[model samples]
Target: MSFVPIICGKRDWDVEYAQSQEYNAIYCPNCHNYKVRPVKRREFITIWFIPVMPFFWGKQLVCPICNWRQDFKSDEQLKKVLREQDNIRAGKVGG
Candidate 1:
């Protein structure tokens, strides 16, 4: 007789707002790729490739090009990021 143990867990992210042109054009600090996107962070505990529990849901700005993530501590922080993107689109600042 033999027994095997398997452990699995993963973090998931969903695109909450991806309509900002400036956000898409922004360059990633890690990869220097112009593919930064807005995403909401979600973590889950999985058993046998199935999500069993979800936790730590929050807003974030991510660079899909290099898998970089900037988590938001509060709603104000998320709003600030959005405002920054808008400012970039408006040419008020460099993206």
Candidate 2:
């Protein structure tokens, strides 16, 4: 009988922001559009097309239109941007 090798490898899993209101305040320089939003990226070990374990995790602001990504140093830094966006939407000047 011929042996069938199992397919195993690393894979990227992305979780987009789930808020009811889409965050579109961040501008994308690459696409020149307001489609930048936060996303959670996880690198996982996959076996037989199934994710086994996550080895790496990160948060980034990404533009879906142009595939632009900006990594955040910390959760606080990311939160600061979200708060600024909220302020901007509220018409608060000089956030």
Q: Predict model 1's lDDT versus the native.
A: 0.71
12 Cα displacement, candidate 2 (Å): 2.7
Off by over 4 Å in 1: 1-4, 16-18, 73-76, 82-95
- Candidate 2, which segments miss by more than 4 Å at Cα? 18-22, 79-95
TM-scores, one per candidate: 0.62, 0.65
> Superposing all C-alpha atoms, what RMSD in Å does each candidate have to the true structure?
4.0, 4.4
Model 2: per-residue Cα lDDT over 1-95, one tens digit each: 99999999999878985544645557676888777888888999999989999998888889888899988877578778878766866899574
Clashing pairs in 1: none
Among residues 3 or more apart in sequence or in different chains, the pairs in candidate 2 whose N, CA or C atoms overlap within 3 Å are none
Q: Name the top lDDT candidate.
A: 2
Count of clashes, each model: 0, 0
Relative to the true structure, candidate 1 has a C-alpha RMSD (angstroms) of 4.0
TM-score of 2: 0.65
lDDT of 1 by residue, 12-72 (tens): 7585664755445655678876677777677888887788888778777787667888876
